[model samples]
Target: MTSLLRILRFAPQLNPLYLGIAVSSVLAALLSLATPFLIGAATDRIVDAVAGRTGVAEAVTAVTWLAVAFLAVEVAATAVVSVGGYWGDVMAARMRTVLSTRYFEHLLHLPQRYFDTALTGRITNRLNRSITELTQFLQFFANNAFTMLITTAAVLVITGFYWWPLAVLLAVVFPVYMWLTAKTSTKWQVWEGEKNTEVDVASGRFAEVVSQMAVVRAYNRQEHELAGFRERFTKTVGLTRTQSRFWHGMDAWRRLAMNVVFGLMYLIVFVRTAQGLFSVGDMVILLQLMNMARQPIFSMSYLVDSAQRAVAGSKDYFAVLEEERERAGGRALEAGEVRAVPNGPAEARADVVEGETVPLPADVPAVRFTDVTFAYDDDAARPVLDRVTFEAGVGEKIAFVGESGGGKSTITNLLMGLYPVGDGRIEVFGNDVAGLDLAAVRGSIATVFQEPFLFSGTVRENIAYADPDATDERVRAAAKAAYADSFVEGFDHGYEQIIGERGLRLSGGQKQRIAVARAVLKDAPILVLDEATSALDTRSERLVQAALEELMVGRTSLIVAHRLSTIASVDRIVTLRAGRVEEIGTPAELSRSGGIYAQLLQLQQAGTKEAKRMLKEYGIHG
Candidate 1:
């Protein structure tokens, strides 16, 4: 009930519409009171006429009129109820849109850790359930609950008009009934909360298994997974059974209370009639009104249940919204800087400034890291990157060579502002990346990773991900440059081929090429190749390397070096050892220096020549 009241606190914004709903509800309630009076009067006349106390013709006439009046009252009540429902729906829809959209928008901006750590099914289940209950609870409160209150009050007042004692007796009993219900219902509220959490857990497990069915089958763990699911399912069933039995017990007591109240009201009516103070028709009306009170009386308890469900659902929904949003305190991206230009591509809008758009100067490095230090977690003893400083000026291709934990990829993550820096600065075009919109900072750089992830869409759509509005000519050109055009054209649908989820339908080499095409299509000033061509056959590597060379011609590129031979043509190579700069020089200079770079190069060229020999037999080069 507290949650119910708290949610209704949002009703002030819908005052005018809510006020209309209120008026309509009252009208319906007042009209409902007409039923008992009209029927009671008609019943009296029909009885008298049948007994010859009144002429048959006159009684028939009177009864016909009463029936007509009753019909009219019902019609009017129905019309008023319809109008109330309309306004209730409008308010409900508005609230749903505001709350869910805001919730989803919060999800969109939440820090990366939320997505990485949260369960997909749990998030979705909470989102969906919360929305459903919130809408139901709110809509019922706005119209149905209001109407019930009015009907209850109108019945009491009409009873008082005929007999004040009856109304007073009700006023006292109603509060006690409500109070008892609240106390008992408090316990069931915990049941609803427990059920919701268990559902989330079950949903999460089911979702994970469904998404990873292949792994489950390969590992032959179906029985193991089923045992876990059965455990959760049994717990849910036990909780549900206990909650239902308790409610059923409470229901028996509720019926006893209702019967007692009905009998008391009947006894008082009979006493008044015996005292010659009330007519039989008056007694009939009191009985009719008492019967009408049943729905609203039970409804009060039901609504309390609904309110509890709403409260529980709201907790889950707000938990998601309460997560920290990404820090976006930076200048907005300039028009034509990252996203596609409004009218056309960048080539078409070379000097066309549509509005107050700022362009980066031509001479500044595409990106620069100055004494940057970072850790994924703040309390960690060792940082991923410590005082890592480097610069990639315009069109200068630089590569970072390191062991697995040497923080090569972390540099790119820092530059992209995916994580907050523990200390120091990263700049894009001389402006602190922190002081520029993170989206814009990311937009200015096109990245291709080792494991390219392509969504389940057509080849054209995947390639045009960087610029959804790209023309067919642009898509084909980018694909051709990345050597993806040959295979794509071979497909039955050509550019429209439906690649399966994560591009699983395509070979690894094919997926990487499409990724390269996507980056090429963006034509951003900065390019990031994070082991982009690693794990490919020599034949595929050569093709991808050629495409990489084409894409790097004008943009400043940062290459996370995976192999020694590939990066020999780069402007400079920075060797990182255990998260610190160990050496920095040209490939030729490093090879001649007899240091870490020289040792790494010698070690790589020493791999048993058999694998390389077989690869060379198939016209492959590495």
Candidate 2:
């Protein structure tokens, strides 16, 4: 119930629509109350005519008027119900929109680590399940809740007027049935939660298998994956069977209780009519009201069913929404407040405006990592980077060469603020990264990763991702610089060519070049190439390396490379071993220093089997 209330709070603008539905529902229900009375009056008129107690013409006239009034009331009620239904449908749609939008926005603000540890499909599955149940319940309640209450109230009042005992019998059934249903609430919800877990895991795995179908086929594990998927859903089926039996078992008892009370009411009404204590018309009206009361009474079970599912679904939804959002950039200060820039002159105090770019001081290095340390979120895991320190001067190109898991990529990830450093500081252009606006810090850098991820969109769309508003000419120029323009022009649609998911339709080189083109289009002051060309063939490597060289000029470039040839032209090389910096020097100086870098360089130059063994021993890739 609390979760349902929280869901409603997500869309306050729908309040007026909800109120309108309630109003229409009440009007419809009140007008419907005239139905039984009109029918009873007509029945009494016929009885009088047949018994010769009233003149035929007068009896016919009364019956005719009663029919007309009943028709008018039914028409009005229908119109009111139609309006309420329309408003309910509209509100439900808008509720879904608001919920989905807010959930997606929340995800965008979550920390990167959240994505690392969570499955893509599981996250989306929660959103779909939660919003679907909430929207449905909201729509159902809007259309039926007020009408049910009003009808039930009218039944109580009318029954009391005819005979107070009949009202007592009808009212007693409601609480008794409700109490019986409440007994199963805890157990029902427990089963629902357990079923949801199996469903979510299956959904997550389903998405993962689909996305990696190529790998599955390559390894001939299609049967294995299918078995796993089936096993998960099979468990859900077993749970549903047990859950259904319990719910319906309780519902059977509730229905039996209601039927027994209704039978007693009927006997009392019949006995009174025969005893001359009430007219046949009075008996008719009482029975008709009882039937009306039954509708809402039966509907109680359905509403409870929906409410339980809604509560359970919303529990998961609210849990995600309640998580602490990733920290954002600092707000702009007042005019008199001082904004300190670390490593800046102590005498200098400045006012910082929100969302405005402030240039770095000229003398500050483009990038700096001072005694930085980090580890993944595992108790047994060692630090990936331990007190690693390095700096890149403005417009200088530095390369990091190391064995696998030697912290080469970790350095760039820290500089980009993807993960928090455990100790020490990372400064981007002389500002402590911890306090600087993350958007501003990341805006000045562009990265080309080893695995280029492209959406299923047009080439133009992917390239313009860096700057959505960039003109066609700028996009083409960037593509040309990355040597992708020629191949793009060869396509049937030129720049408008549709690139399949992750550019699956294109070759590896083509995909890498497209990624390079995106980075070129960004044109940030700092560039990061994390094994960007390592996966390409010889010819593709040359082409991409050339494009990278063109992109690196006049910018501060951070290069993590396995092939020594790629770093031969870098201004300096930083060699790492076992999460620590082993050596840092110019390419020529490191080549002769007999350090890790020199040994790897010497081994790479030799193509013999012994050289390969030595390289493998160091876990270095040639």
Candidate 3:
């Protein structure tokens, strides 16, 4: 119930039109109340005419007038209903648009970990179902539920006028029904929660399998994936059956209770008619009123159940909405200048590389991590980065080199402020990153990942993503700088060629170069290449590495490099081992020290040779 109220706070309002809808609803309901009386009177008049107690002409006239009046009222009620329904739909559409957009904006602010760990289908299911269910509930409450209440209230009023005792009986019967319903609805809520969870699991499993179609085929696990999906499907079917049966069981019990009361009311009215205390017309009204009341009573379980489901769905939606967003900070960023806090002087550092340690010049480094430590999970035994510290002076190029799981990539994630850091401060321009406005901090840097992702758009559109309002000439210049202009111009449509999803239509070299072009266009003070050329072939890697060099020239650059060419000219190489920094020095300096950095470099050289030998055997290399 609380969740339902919370969801309704987003409900669209018709403002002054609500009064019109209400007036129309009340007028329609009142017109309906006239039915029982007019019907009863017409029946009595025919009886009176047949017995010669009333004149034939007068009886016909009275009956004709009554019919005309009923017709007019019915026509008026229908018109009122049409207007009311139109506003109801308007409100429903507005609510759906507002709620869904709010959910989207909330997701934009969510931390990266949410996307990392949360199931795609579960989040989508919750988002989709909440909006759908809430919309239905709102429409039902505004129209059908409102109509049912007015009809019930009108019946109660007429029933009391016909006979006080029947009204009193109704008052007693429905209160008991409501009390039982309240208890049953509590149990239904529990079941409904479980049912929704099962649905999300089934939805997520289907999505996961479909999205990983290549992996399933490559691994020959089609049958295994099918079995997994079937298991979830079977569980959801069972839950659906249970939900259906529970609702019907409760509905049947309530119907029986309502019918029993109705039967008793019939007997009471029959006795009164026999005693000559009431006319046949009065008995007609009594039965008509009870029938009207019966309809709402029959629909009670459905309305109550919908309310419960809406409440549960709203809670699911809010669960995501209520999560904490990236914390905001006080620092402002300028377009050309980047703020990077340098680590304390490398004095007393165990991981110091053997060479004269150069303190990053104090012009406020473009990027800095000082004793920064963090673990992806609190229960993780060892943090991913332990007391890791580094700094890049303005326009200085630094590279992180290590084997996988040694935390080379974690540095980029931290610098981008994608995750929260707890142990130490990361400074951008001397301001603690934790205290700097994240939007401004992120806006100050550009990143190109090993897997270059492209949206489904034209070649020109992809480049312009860095600055949507960039001029055509500006975009072309950026592309040329990354060495992508030649390949792009070769396309049949030139820059207008539509790239397939994630640039699947482009070669590895082409995609990486376009990604670099985007970074070039962004022209931020800082650039990060996280294994950006590692996945390419020799030719592609050479092209992409060359493109990266042009992009990094005037920016503070951080590279998590896998190739010797990428590290050869870096100002400093920071070596990581088991989540701690092993050394920081020039690539030449580290190679001479014969430490962890030198050993990893040697292994990579061997792998490169083996790869070349394999390529030569395949006639692709000399």
Candidate 4:
């Protein structure tokens, strides 16, 4: 109930339309009350002529006037209801838009850790189910809530004027039926929640399997996945059956109670009229009013059902909204400044006027990491990074080389502020990362990941992702710089060719080159390449590596590589093992030092003669 009330808190902005619907519904209900009175008058007049108490001519004239009034009232009620219904439909659509946009905006602000734990499909399912149910209930309530209230009240008053006992009988049904329904509410909601869980999990798996259909077929796991999906839905069906049985069983009891009460009221009305205590006209009106009361009593049950579902839906929707949003500030960066971070004390440098270039000071780096430690799981005993300290000077091409899961990628992630730091400091462009604006930091840095993630759009769009407003000429130049222009030009539509989801339509090297071109267009002062060419074949790797070389020039680049030979030309190599830094030196120095770098080099040279020759050519003598 509280959750449903919280949903109403967002309705104030649409209060005028809400008020309009209420007023119209009330007016229609009032007009509709006139029908029974008009019919009752016509009936009495006809009875008088039949009993020879009045002339047929006078009776027919009275009945004709009443029939005309009844027609007018019915027409007016219909028109009022139509107008209210129109307002309700419009309000419901706008509410859907408001709720969906609010949910999406909050989703974008939630920290990365939220996405890491929640399934994408399940998150999407919650939004769809919750918003759909809520808006439906809201629209129904707006159209019928006031009408039901006014209609039931008028029936009670009109019936009581004729017979108080009938009013008492009608009133008793409400509390008894409500109590019966209330007794099952807690259990009903519990079942609803369980069914929702089953549905969400099954839907999540459905989406996952669809996206990875190639892998499922490759491994011949289609039957296995289908069996899992069916098992979940089977559980959902069983739960739904049980729930329906309970609800309908209670409904049967409620209807029986209503029927018995109405029968007594009807018997009383007939007996009292025969004893001359009530006239035929009075009896007719009383019975019709009682029938009207029956409608609202039945409608109450439906309203309760809708309210219950709405409460459940609002609970799920607001739960996500209550989550902590990311507090990272939005700050833009200045262009053409060589900010420095000193290893020891601060060094004095000349300050220049606005937009003037400053020379980078000696022994000062563009980026610095000091004793940084982090772990994905807070309860885990071993952290992913342990007191890792490193530096990348301005315009220096530094590479990190290590085996799998050696925290090489973790360093890059930390530098990008993708995860919160556990201990120690990280500085980008002489500013501590924790205190600096995240947007400004990210603005100066560009990253190319191992597997390029591109949206399903044109090749030109993918290249311009780094700068959405970039001109066609600028896009072409960046593509040319990355050596992707040749292949792109060969496509049927050239730059306008549609790349499928995650660049599925493009070859592996083609995807990587487009990613490289995006970074090239960004032209940031700092570049981070995380195994960019590791997933390609020899020819593709050569092409991608050549493009990467062109993109990395004159920038502070950090390369995370598994292939030893690929990073041989870097200014320096930082070797890591088991979350700890093992060695830091130039490729030539580390090759002769017999550290992790030398061991990996030896392993590479132990392969084919061509591999050995490649290692030797990269200045590795093992």
Q: Encode model 2's per-residue lDDT on 236-322: one tens digit a residue.
A: 999999999999999988898889889989999999999999898888888899999999999999998999999999998888877
lDDT of 3 by residue, 214-234 (tens): 788999998887787678768
| Worst window of 10 by summed lDDT in candidate 4 | 349-358
- Residue pairs in candidate 3 whose N, alpha carbon or C atoms collide under 3 angstroms: 339-428, 339-429, 340-366, 340-429
Number of clashing pairs per prediction, in order: 0, 0, 4, 0
For residues 1-622, write the lDDT of model 4, one tens digit per residue: 7776677776578888889999999998899788789988988999999999999999999999998899999899989999999999999998898888888978875767888988888899999999999999999999998988899888888887877877777777778878888887888888888888998899889888988999999999999999999999999899989988998788888888888998889899999999999889888888888888888888877888887788788888988888876543322222222333223235653332222221334567888999998999999889988999989999999998765677888898888777778898998767777765454566678899999988899999999987888899999999999999999999999999999988999999999999999999888888999989878888988888998888888999999864666678899999887788889999999999998778667768578777666544333322
Q: What's the TM-score of every candidate structure? A: 0.87, 0.94, 0.89, 0.89
**For model 2, where is the 10-residue window of minimal lDDT?**
328-337
TM-score-based ranking = 2, 4, 3, 1
Error at 206, model 2, angstroms: 1.2
lDDT of each: 0.80, 0.86, 0.79, 0.83
- Model 2: residue 616 alpha-carbon error in angstroms: 5.9
Q: What residue pairs are clashing in model 4? A: none
Q: State in Å the error of residue 488, model 1.
A: 2.5
- As for candidate 2, its clashing pairs are none
